[model samples]
Each structure stands twice: as C-alpha cells, then as structure tokens.
Target chain A: MKRGVFKRSLDSLESIFLFTSEFVRENHVDPSLLPAIDLIVEELFTNMVEHSSASTADVPMEMSTVDGGVEVTLTDEDADPFDITKVPEVDVERAVEELDPGGLGLHLVRKFADSVEYHYQFSNRQARIVFRKTAGSGGDDV
Target chain B: MFDLERREAGEVVLKGRFDAAQREKAQALFDEIHESVTLDCSELDYISSAGLGVLLKTQKRLLAEGGRLKLIGVNSHLRDVFKYSGFDRIFEIEPG
Candidate 1:
C-alpha cells in the first residue's frame, strides 16, 4: 500500500488530486475511472476539513491494488465520531429550487464507489473510511 | 484571485480547476451579473463542491428572476459530477 499525509485545509485539495492522479497513472488504474475516484476523494477530504472539530486534521490515506480493483483508506483525527456512510441519500427528483447543496458530497461518494465502509476508533479519536472500486464498476456515465 | 474570462457571446469560460480557493471570487462574479447566461465549461477540468455551491446559488437566483443559467460543453468527466449531484436535472446541459 502507498501512503501519504495531507493537511486538513482547502488548499490541500489540489495536492491530493495531484498525488492521486499520479498514483493512478503509475498503478495502471483504468483512465476512465479517474473521475469517479477524484470526486470521491474530494468529497471525503472536504467533508473532513469542513465538519471535523479536530485542531490538527492530518488526513492519512493509503491506496493499493487489489484483485480487479483499487482499495483506498482515508483516516482523520477528529474530536467527535463521524460516520459519513450513514448519511441518508437525498431525493434526486426534488425541484431545482428546493435542491440544497448539503449532503450531496457523501451522496455522490456512495453513488460512484462500489463499496464504502466507515469505522471510528474511540481510543484514538479518529475516523476511517474505506472504499473499493473496480474497473468498469462505477458506471459509464462519465 | 480567480480570473473571470468572458466571451463576446456572454458566456463565461471557466478554465483549470475551481476549488474552495476560488469561492469568494466566483461569488463576486455571480453577484454582479443578473441576466441570462450560459457557462461555457469546455475548458474546465475540475470543480470542487465549493465551486458547485456557487453555481447552485447563482442558478437559484437566476431562476427566481425568470432568467436561466445553462451549462454548455460539459465533458463526460464533469457531467458525471453533475449527474451524481442531481444538478444535471436542474441545469440545461448542452452537448459538447
């Protein structure tokens, strides 16, 4: 598994994207799947930055090649326990005027990723989210 | 500071990435415009949720005043983002 650490600031978003892009390219991940992975990373990273109450949010991430897919784990230290996988999905049929921006980030993460799991460690006061996506698994929408 | 690149046809062409860093500038750009506008995003490669929120707010304001905010030249990558966020149903997306 390849690992990296990112600061919990909005500016760190670009670094995450750049690192993931290079990682995907080096690992031979399918080019078509990059966008799905990109969106997932952004949403999760930003969620941690905006919602977490931790004074030092060091986002530690790992990426590895699995059987017919890629596995990813994102960890963050926060004062409160948060489970992003539990966020309820929003109704897509809502009128444009009624569509609020909240919750769309996690909603998209669940929609595009093949598998998502969340875990919180009370001892360490940290939250971890894992995801796995296989080539051609997300969708042909992109 | 975010650069506002406008075209002669009243289309705002967004280039490169639009992230949280550009949120304030983008909001200011939207605040000054009140007419119907089409955002040309053919050159846009990436947009974060903050940027999406700006677009959503602008669309909401435009819709309230009977004006329209359309998106044209959205590539499949960005289209997927819109589709997942349910913005595809809200905005008129012209084929690239």
Candidate 2:
C-alpha cells in the first residue's frame, strides 16, 4: 500500500495533511486522532526538509497508511543517521533570551503521537508513529 | 523558511512563511545582517516549530555579535505562541 510522496516544502504540508486525512477519514479512522497525525507529520517532515534539503540537497519523501496507521518515511541520501528520539528535551519553562527554539519539533512529535519508533537501514532513517483508536480519535485536529 | 531583507533604516524584514522549505533561504538571508536586525513578522501567518527553531537560532547569532532580533507587527496569535514558548523573554517584540 503506497501512500503519497511530497517534495520537501512548506506549501506541501497542507496538501499532505488533507490527502492523508481524506484517506483516513473515509474508512475505519477515528476523528479525534487526526491532529496528532498532522502534528507529527509536520514536525518530522519539517525537520527533514530543513536539515536535509535546506542544507544539503533534494531528498526523497514517501508517506503511506500501513498497519492501520499513517506512516511517513523520508529518504535522504548522505543524510546523517540522526534519531529524533535521541535528542534531549527542551526546558520550555526556562528563562532565556534569544534562545534558538531548540528541541520543539521532535518534542511535539513524541508528545502528540501514541508511540514513535525509529529504524535505520542502508543509511536511511525513518521515524514511524502509531496512533491507536481511542473511542473518539482521528488524526485531523491540528 | 523566511527571507531576511535589510531595509533602509537598518531593519531586517522577513517576508514569507518560515516553514521547512524556506529554512535554507532564511539562513542565507540571516547571514547578510551585521547588526541589530528588526524582523518583519507581520506577513508571517503561520510558523511551525521548525520555523521557531530557526528564529531562535538567528536571534542567538545576532545577539552574540552585539546585535539583536527585534520582531515588529507580530499578530496576536503568533504573539501568543511566542509568549507561550517563553520566547517573549528572548526577543524584543514591538507592536506595529
């Protein structure tokens, strides 16, 4: 089951969310769980574009619904084997001035998703998340 | 991503949504400023955490060089985000 692949860009985010949402909403997907999907996607996908494409070069991104959940896998040739789960958490409550908004992207992904896991094979790193259906949940809130 | 532009009065105005895609370009624009930079955040309708990250980094860079990141005309919504993130303690945000 192939989902959809998008070029790394800001304009593509809405389409990605809408496209995934449409697919999820039409079937056995719950409504309360949509925002989580969108948020995690934005957080992870945004990092891919920024750190990979923004600094390096054009990268490949593919997304699909697998195992009864939405999966977005990004492939970046020569990308560092960075794992989002390994990054340290940002102390959002700290008093600071002009601090780089550090640690928010991956932080949001982990906070909103039910479960997030990472895999690396052949130099490609993938962050996979699963959202469980909890009575009234759909990945479309945000 | 955001485009940092230097105005005539020493203002570094950014015009565009600072998302994943525009990040590199924003970095390039940020490199051009040598002093205190006033970022135009009015047209900025939405900012992901990634954008926020870049803004934070850029602010740090400018501040370390005896410069600063001043935001002008930030909408109430984004202002709330800045406030919520406690970024208000970092950057000098002025109402436009």
Candidate 3:
C-alpha cells in the first residue's frame, strides 16, 4: 500500500495525480485503468476540499493493489459527516438548459468506480471514502 | 499539463488533462467564445467533472446566444464519459 497526505486545496490535485501515478507504476496496475482511477480520485478529493468543512490541512489517501484491480481510501479529518453515497442522484438525462453542474463530480465518481463505500467516525469527525476499480470493470453498465 | 488554444482558423484545441485545477484557465478561454465553434479534442487525454462543468457552462451560454459548440476527435474513453454523464446529448460530438 502507498500513502500520501495532501494539502486541502485544489492546487493539491497536481500532487495527488503524481502520487497516484507513482502508486500505479509501483503496483503494476494496468495502464488502461489510469484514466478511471485518476477521474475517481479527483472527484472524491475535490468533494472533500469543496464541501467538507474539515479543519485539518492534510487529507490522507491510501492506494493498494487488489485482485485484478486497485483500491483507494481517502479520509477527510475533522469534518462533518457528509455521506457521499447519499448524495441525490444527478439527472444526466436532463436537457442542456435544465442541467445543473452541481453534483456532477460525485455522479461521475459513482459511474466510473466498480464500488464505492463511505464510513464516518463520529468521535473523530472523520469521513472515510473507499472506492475500488477492477480490471475490465468500468461502471458504464452500472 | 492542459493546454487550451484558439487557432487562427477559430477552432479551439484542447490537449492533455482537464481537471479541477485547469478550470479557471479553460473558463477564461471559453468565456471569450460567443459564436458557434468547434473544439478539437483529438489530443485531450482526460477530463473530470470539473472540466465537464466548464464545457457545459460554455455550451449553455452559446446556446442562449443562438450558437453551439461542436466537439470532434473525442477518443472512446472520453466518449464514454460524455455518454455516462449524458453530455453526449448536449453537444455534437464526433469520435476521433
């Protein structure tokens, strides 16, 4: 498993990408999976930075190889419980004029990852989001 | 590393990743486009929802002004993103 603690800002996205690249290379993850992994990580991290009122400056992330896939865990410390899984579904079928950009990031996260799970620790005010993407398993059919 | 450039012929070319960090730069470029235009995404490797948001905003604005944004040279992976996000219906896309 590889771990990284990133600053709570959009600028940290570059660092996050670098960390993800290193993890992918080190773990021998499939190169085809890079885009999906990158997309999922970016959406989740962006959510934490924009929505989670976390007081901590560091957002910890962990990535590891799983059977025919990769797993990632992100924790937002000192933040309120925002169950990302509970976010209302975005109506992608909505007309262009009616479509709202809000929630689109989370929507994509759900569509690209094979599985998404959320856990919150009340005592510590921490939100942990874990998602997995398996080889040959894009969430297109989900 | 994302680059958005407007060529002298008036087509906008996009290359590299377009994520949250590149939103402001993309928006600045899109803001100046008021008429119908083609966005050449042949070199665009990846795009997140933040990037999608910029495109949606620009498309909407253009539509309001009786114009549209046509996208060409989109790879299969990006086409999937558009299909999953329902953005395929919002813009005219020609696969690369």
Candidate 4:
C-alpha cells in the first residue's frame, strides 16, 4: 500500500492526480481502469475539500492493488459524520431547464466505482471513504 | 494542464484534464458564448463532475435562449462518463 496526505484545498487536486498516476504506474494496474479511478478519486476528494468544515488537518489517502483492481481510501480528519453512502440519489432524469448540479459529483462516484463504503469515527470525528474500481466492473460502457 | 480556446468559427476546443481546479477558467470562457456552440473535445483527456457542471450550466443557459451545446470528438472513456451521467441524452455528442 502507498499512502499520502494532501492539504484541504482545491489546488491539491493536481497533486492528488499525480500521486494516483504514479501509484497506478508502479502497480501496473489496467490502463483501461485509469479513467474510472481518476474520476472516482477526484469526485470524492473534491467533495471532502469543498464540504467538510472546521478541519485544517490534511486528508490522508491510501492506494493499493486488490485481486484484479485498485482500492483507495480517503480519510477526512476533524470532520462531521457525513455518510456519503446515504446521500440522496440525484434526479438525473430532470429536464435541462430543471437540472441542478448539486450532488452530481457523489452521484458519479457511486456510478463509476465498483463499490463504495463509508465509515465514521465519533471519537476522532473522522470520515473514511473507501472505493474500489476493478477492470470490467461498473459502467458497462466503460 | 487544461486549455480552452474559442476558434474563429465559434467552436471551443478543450484539452487535458478538466477537474474542479479548471472549472473557473472553463466557466469564464463559457460565459462569453451567447449562441449555440460546439465544444470540440478531441484533445480532452478527462472530465469529472465539476467539469460536467460547467457544461451543464452552460447548456441550461443556452437552452433557455433556444440554443444548445453540441459536443464532438469525445473519446470512449469520456463517452462512458456522459453515458452514466445521462448527459448523452442532455447534449448532442459525436464520438471521436
């Protein structure tokens, strides 16, 4: 497993992408999986940076290879109990005139990732979100 | 490494990764358009929901004015993103 920490800012996305790219390269993960991995990570990481409040600590990320895919975990320290898995589904069928962008990021996360799990630690006020993307999994078109 | 350029013919070209960090730059460019336009994404490598939001906002605005955003040169990976998000139905997309 490889681990890194990024500051709680939008600019950290570039660094996070670099970290993800390096990890995937070193691990020899399927090239076809890069898009899903990138999208899922970006959505989840940006969600934390944008929504998590009262936290100055950096977010920790871990990446590792699983059976036929990669697994990533991001922990937001000093954050409230915001269960991402329970977020309401987005009404994607809304017409263009009524379409709202809210919750779309997490909606994409759920769609692209093979599995998404969320856990919160009350004592430390930590929100840990882990997602896995496997080759030939999730989005049929992908 | 994201770039957006508006051509003389009014087509906007997009390149590189369009994540949350590039949203403002993309929005600024989209704000300049008032008519139906085609976004040439031939060189675009990736787009997250943030980028999608920018396109969605622009599409909504243009649709309100009886105009729409047409996307062309989308790669397979991006096609999946659009397909899963139901954006394929929202916009006219031409696969690269």
Candidate 4: regions farther than 4 A off: A140-142
Tell me the DockQ of each model, to 2 decimals.
0.58, 0.23, 0.64, 0.72
Please, what are the lDDT tens digits per residue for candidate 4 over residues B1-96? 788888867588999999999999988978988999899999999999888999999999899898999999999888988887889989999999
Chain A TM-score for predicted structure 1: 0.93
**lDDT by residue (tens digit), candidate 4, A1-142:** 9999999988998999899889889999886788789899889888888887578889999999998889999999999888999999998887877887788889988988989999999998988999999887875353
Most DockQ-accurate candidate: 4
Q: Could you tell me which 10 consecutive residues in candidate 3 chain A have the lowest summed lDDT? A: A133-142
Against the hidden true structure, what lDDT does model 4 obtain? Answer: 0.89
lDDT tens readout by residue for model 2, A1-142: 3356666666687677676578677655654455455556677767776666534444344545555465555554455567677788767766555244666777656555555666555434433333332222222222
lDDT, candidate 3, at A122: 96
- The global C-alpha lDDT for each of the candidates, from Candidate 1 onward, is 0.79, 0.61, 0.89, 0.89
Q: Pick by TM-score: which candidate is best?
A: 4
B19-73, model 1: which lDDT tens digit per residue? 6767788889888768888888888877656778888998999888988788998
If both were scored by DockQ, which would come out higher, candidate 2 or candidate 4? 4
In CAPRI terms, where does candidate 2 land?
incorrect
Model 4 residue B75 lDDT? 93
Candidate 2, after superposition: displacement of residue B51 in Å?
A: 2.4
DockQ computed for model 2 against the true two-chain complex using alpha carbons: 0.23
Q: What is the lDDT of candidate 2?
A: 0.61
Please give the clash total of every predicted structure, in order: 0, 21, 0, 0
The digit string of per-residue lDDT tens for model 2 on B13-96 reads 666556665666776667767777677877765555766777777777777788787889886545645655667778788765
